[model samples]
Structure formats: C-alpha cells, structure tokens
Target: MLKWQWRQGIVTLFFVAVGLLLAILVGYSQPAFRSADSGSLSARSGVKIEYPVAEIKTGLPLPSDRTEVQMAAACLPPQRTPTALSFQAKLVTPEPSRAVPKYKPQQRQEKVHPTNYGNRMQRDVHHRRVNNELLVVLHETVGDAHGAISTFQTPHYDDDNQVSYHAVISRNGTVIYLVPANKRAYGAGNSEFIGINGVEAVQTNPSLASSVNNFAYHISLETPVDGLLDDHPEHSGYTQKQYQSLAWLIARTGVATSRITTHAAIDREGARQDPRSFSFPKLLSYLNQYPRPTEIPPCPLPPQG
Candidate 1:
C-alpha cells in the first residue's frame, strides 16, 4: 500500500514538470505582453522595440548636470524657421493693381514732320516683308518731344549729325506720332539683328522672337523739363506721368513684356541710354500681369546711350 501511494505521487509530479516546460516554450516563440515602464516585452526570433510612450508625453528630462539636448538632437538638421513647430495654413489671394493716370494722343500742331509721317512709297515696300517681332529698345528723350522729334527730322542741322525714333512723349503725357510702329526707325546705331539688319535683328533672333509675344513692347517716354535742360542727365529718373503713359502705350503695342528690353541691354557697344532710371523689378511686376501677343512684328527699336 505504501509503494502504490508513492508511485501516484511520482506521476503527479512528472505531469506538473511537463506543463511548466510547454508554457516556457510557447512564450519563447510568440510575441508577449508590452509593459508601460519598459517599452514592449515581446519574445520573438528577432524582435524590435518601440520607444516608451511615457518618455514622449513628457519630453525626457535633460540630464541633471550640464544638461544639453545636443546628444538627443544630434541626428537632426538645424531648423531655419522659428515657426517650424507651428501648423501651416496657406491663404492664396489676388493682388490689387496700382493707380495709373490717363494718356491722350496728341495732335501735332505742325503737320507732323514729313519725315515723321511714313512715306506712302516706303510703306508699300516694307508691308510685305515685315516680320512679326519688334525689338523694343526704350530710350529717355534727352530732350523734350519737340527737340527730339526735330533732331530726327532735320539731320543736317542736328549736332548728333543724325537721329530717328518711332514715337515721342510730350511733357503732359501726350504721345506724339512719328513713324508708324511697323516701319523701321534709325534709333540704335551700328546695331544688328540675329537674322536681319540693325534693330530688325532682334526680331530675327529665335530667343528674342519668342519673348516678343510675352515681355516686350515699344514706346519712347519723355522725361521732365530737367531731363531736357541738362541734356537728359536726370532722364534716368523719369516722371510718374511718363511712366503711366509708357505702361499704356506698351499695352497697345501688342508686344510681350518679356521682349521689352532697355537700349543698354541690346547694344553692348553703343551711345544710346534711354528709358533712364529704369526699375527692373517694377517693370517685371507690370509684365507679369499682362498677356503675351500672338503675332510677332518684324520692327525693332534701336540701342541707345
């Protein structure tokens, strides 16, 4: 009876030991519980652990002595913006246009000079051969409209010995008519076009031809009396009235803003300086709002001093 009792005890002990061994094997092969204090406590072949949530909620306390977050932030690039942590919300809106004065086309008191008006015979010849681009070179009338127009007209009497331009601006924002926009004017000196002669060359250049429709136009703005009195020394800084008129004139020219270039830009080596006091950013701002033209005119402006 004692021996039988002992055998029963031994069998019970063996079963208990086997159960514990099976439990340990299962735990070792499967993912286990995650603890709050020490990230996830998982048992797998090759396991990865995430950072403790508690550390994130309250930024980990900096070390007590000489505490610097440098070690923790070392892997990150320096932030340039102060508001980097702020939520971004974009607001797209249209900009308003600046005020502009009115422009009235002037009626020449003296029958516009014979040279100023296009010759009937000359017009017929150029009409068929005209291109679609106009190399617009802006100039500051060193003199008023009257003196400028007169100089271009009376070649023999003028001191510069020769002069010519397509149009002129009077002091009161009046646009004086001269040669037709379609006709070539003797503005730029010793200038050549990419595929044509002189000012017309700009029209012929492939790059310039493309910009003609978007960023270029032709107009001669009249500087204030000071510009003329001092031989247009101050013409670089033109008047608000003339600028207003020029903006309007360019709109009418059907040229693109991109194609509009200063005389100085085109003529690397020349004696023309016009549209003095030009503001590139201001002009670019104006052009950005305007549309490009479809037709490319063949006429171009000359380089100036």
Candidate 2:
C-alpha cells in the first residue's frame, strides 16, 4: 500500500507543472515581448521563450509596420512623356470683296474743215461762161481776213471747180477778185433773180433786191460793215470808207439803185435786219441823183414766205 501511494504522488506533481506552463503561456500572449537579456519576469518564470509567436509580414515583402507599407503602395511609377493635344481654333472669316468694273463711254472724232472751193477751174472754162442774167449776191465779211479767206476757199462752197464770187470786200474796203465778169459764180445757193426773170411772186422790191440783182455781168459786191443787226461795236459794223467803196462797186456793176436786198431781206426770216446803222433814205436819195436812162418800174414788195 505504501508503494502505490508514492506513484500517485509523482503523477500529481507532473499535472501541476503542465498547468503552470499553460498559465505562463497565457501571460506571454497578453503582454508585449521583452528582450531575453532584459531579465523580464516572464524569462525568470522559466516558461517564456525568445522566439517570435507568429510571422510579422506576408506577401509583398513588407515590413512589420503597416503605415510604411501603405506609403510604398501609394507612390506611383515613372511614366512616358504625354502626347501634345491639337489646339486649333475654328474662326469664321469673311470672303474677299469682288472687284468693281468702271463704266466709260466712247469718244467721237471731229469732222475735217473744208480746204478749197474751186481749185481745179480751168482758165478757158472759167472765162468762157458769161452769165448775162445777173444775180448779184452781196456778202459782208464780219470776222478776220484769215477766216473769210478760209470760208471762201472751202470745197463745199465751191464745188465743180467753178466757185466764183465776183468780188470780196475786206474790212478795210479792199476788194478781192475770185472770178472775172464772164463766169457763173456759185454765190447764191438756192436763189433766183427778181427783176428780169424767174417767178414774179418771188420778186422783191428793186431797191430791196439791188445787191443781189447787181450781178448782171455775173459779179458780186463785197460790202464791209461795222455792226450787223444789233448795231453794236461788239457786232462789228462797216466803216464809212467801206460803205463808199460798196457804192462805187455798185455803180461800176451798173446795178439799178432799186435792187439791193440784204441776205436777210431775201432769206425772209423777218429776222433779216442788216445795214443796221445805215440810212436807206440817204442811199435812195443818192441813187436818185444818179439816174439810169432805163425806165424804172414800181418795185414789187418781197413775198412774206
């Protein structure tokens, strides 16, 4: 019975040692681990160990600190340079203005001035043609001599090489010869003699048609005047010498004093007012003093038309 009691006592001591070890392990799990060399209470208990209870880190090779591992994961890796984006801005622009055309009118050229009236008149033909039925056409040159000559020399006025005005009176009472007494002068364009022949209804008073009728020998008288119808110096009338010369030429032409019509008188515009400052009464009186032997008839008044 004593031997059985000893065995029981030994088994009881083994169970107590196991319980103490389990209690020490529970205490270690509760407190933070201290160094083995620190002489901790756990180390003195003979149940504590220096080795780690569990592994501190897993995956990613992170440290025991969670804060450090999170900072490392947040850090980004280096990247390639970014491509440049297109920055074009669309803008509405106005179209260019169209060119405008300029309108211009065409120009007309001026006509040429006539040169010679009768440059081709032969001497025989000019002298042989004597116009007995005299129809004198008197002309008074108002402008300069150059203009007068130019007018008389124009071909339009003297076509057929037979332009003949018996005489031309200059401003200074100078008489110019265009043709001799024997040729038909183209002095009158659309005209007729009133005294001797042609229509009597067209007949004007002898004194009125005297200037034109005096061309019996186919001659013309050129008279000069200081003024025309207006009778102003600006109108350019005849000088006293020119009037006297005209009278002399009339007397020489043997024109009856009764038949001197101005261009206006025969043309019948009622606008025919010439010898504006001249006295017809005085001229008649002078003519009365120098009478022609032929019996003078009453002058028929010019037709109004």
Candidate 3:
C-alpha cells in the first residue's frame, strides 16, 4: 500500500509544474515563441515575435525577431530627395513665353547715335561724313528702290563714289534705313543753306555757307526708270504712302518745318536741279502736322552797324 501512494504523489507534481508554466505564458502580452514541436523559450533577443496561439497549436514555426524587424522596415515608405522632387515639379509646371512686337521699316537699324555701324561694316568711311545736322534735304534716286539700296550698301569716299543718304523711301513708301541720324550723308555737294531771314550761321558757326552738307539729313525717294523725267509729271510724281512716311520721319526728328528743304533749292553752282517732278503742296499737306512756327522771327541787326 505505501509503494502505490508514492507513485501517485510524483504523478501529481509533474502535472502541477506543466499547468503553472502554461498559465504564465498565456497571461503575458509578450509572446514567448517556441519551436514547432519544441516547448522551449528563447534567450532574451530584444525583439518580439507575434504568433497566434492557434498558429502555435497548429505546427507553424514562429519567425525569429531579426526577420520580423527586417520585414517591418521593408513595408515603410521611402524618403524623398530634393533633386527628384524638383524633376517632378518641372514635369508638372510650364515655361514662360513672350510676345514679339510688330516689325517697322523706319526703325530697322536706325541708330540714334553714330558709331552704331563701323566704317567697314559695308565699306571704309571716306571724307567728312560726320557733322551737326541742321537741315533735312530731300532728293530723288532716279533709280529703282533695289538699285538705290544696293548703292548705299557699298560705302565710298570721293565725289565719284562717296555717297549716301540717311534714309530712302521706296515707291511704295517703305522707309529704308541707311545711316545713323548723328552721322553725315553725302546728300548735298557744293550746296549752301542760308537760314530764312539771312541767318547764315548756326549758333557760333559764322563760316556757315550754302554748302549745307555739314548740317543736313538727306532723305531720298526712289524713282521708276520710266518716271525719272516726265514733262508735267502726273501719276509718277509721288505716292500718298511716300508723303505719309516722309512726314512721319520728319516729325520723329522734331526739326522745324521751315528747316526742311530740297536738294534743288540748296544746290550751288547752278548745275543741280533734282527731286524733279515733286510737289511741295503734297509734302506740306502731310508735313503740316508737325510743329512749325507760325511766322519767322526777325533777325537782329548788328547794333545798327
């Protein structure tokens, strides 16, 4: 009878130990993982593994803490870089654009100052082609527009070749640029400009003469070969467009209307009479819009001599 009681007591102790261990594990939040079939706890690894009690009961192996940490990190979003963000913005944004102004023939390369075009830009500069502008001389090319422009394209010096006009107007009235406003044009030769009322000098320039080349802005008008010389000219005189362009150009300079004269009027030696078949009435009709003195102021006499 005593031998049987000892076996029974040892069996009770074994069951009691197992029951306590299960209670401890089930009550704790931090799961104590065990091998699929091995009921053993791992050493402290500082990583928690989540395994459902059902999974442990079934036979699925509990993943290691290191593997759990690596898998969790892989699921997080990637960090952004400045360069990548900028590229993305560029793809979504548009570039800025500008509108261009309309083209005008008068403004094409018409420099307000000299030195804008070099002497050799077309050809070398010759003789005096630089002087103070006082008169706006008018002329006729006696040639086609193309021929006149081509002529100025080649710079010259002597009276044989030294020639240029500040501007040229085609039969269609397109004002073509030739020289800067501040430069001299070979418009007048042996020509003289005596200001209205016998005022021959410009400011301190007492030596001023009819040779107005020193102070003139020469503007030429193209002539059709057939219309170069006509007796009592009619349709070939000048176009309305030409008159408009001329007046506009004259106004731009702000020069006095009376100061505006013709190549024929200023020509000296009586050998020149150009800008033929022209109508002063037509030119004045358009030029009248500019500011001009109503009357010429009298010239002061030299203290009654």
| Candidate whose TM-score is highest | 3
**What would the per-residue lDDT of candidate 3 be over residues 1-305, giving only the tens digit for each residue?**
89999999999999999999998888994756543223565523543433311122222232343343233322222311111111210112111133311223343443222222212111112332222325678988876766766667654543445567888888777887777555556567567665422332121123323345545677888875666544333335777778777876765554556678888887766655567778888887876655442323332222221
Ranking by TM-score: 3, 1, 2
The TM-score values for the models, in the order shown, are 0.45, 0.39, 0.50
TM-score of 1: 0.45
Writing each residue's lDDT as its tens digit, candidate 2 over 154-249 gives: 556323332335465555656555543433344443344343222311112222232232232222223344342233424434554455455544
Candidate 3's error at 171, in angstroms? 1.1
Better of 2 and 3 by lDDT: 3
Best by lDDT: 3
Better of 1 and 2 by lDDT: 1
**Candidate 3 lDDT:** 0.53
User: For residues 1-305, could you state the per-residue lDDT of candidate 1 as single tens digits?
Assistant: 99999999999999999999999998898634433335554323233323222122223332222112222222122221111112111211222254333443443422234442222121122242223334456876766777777666663433124345666766676766565544445455444433211233323222222122111223566766556656442344765555555565555554444346776665646555666667767654544444434332232232233
Query: In model 1, how large is the Cα lDDT of residue 134?
Result: 41
Lowest lDDT sum, 10 consecutive residues, model 2, at 80-89
Number of colliding residue pairs in model 2: 23
Model 1, global lDDT: 0.45
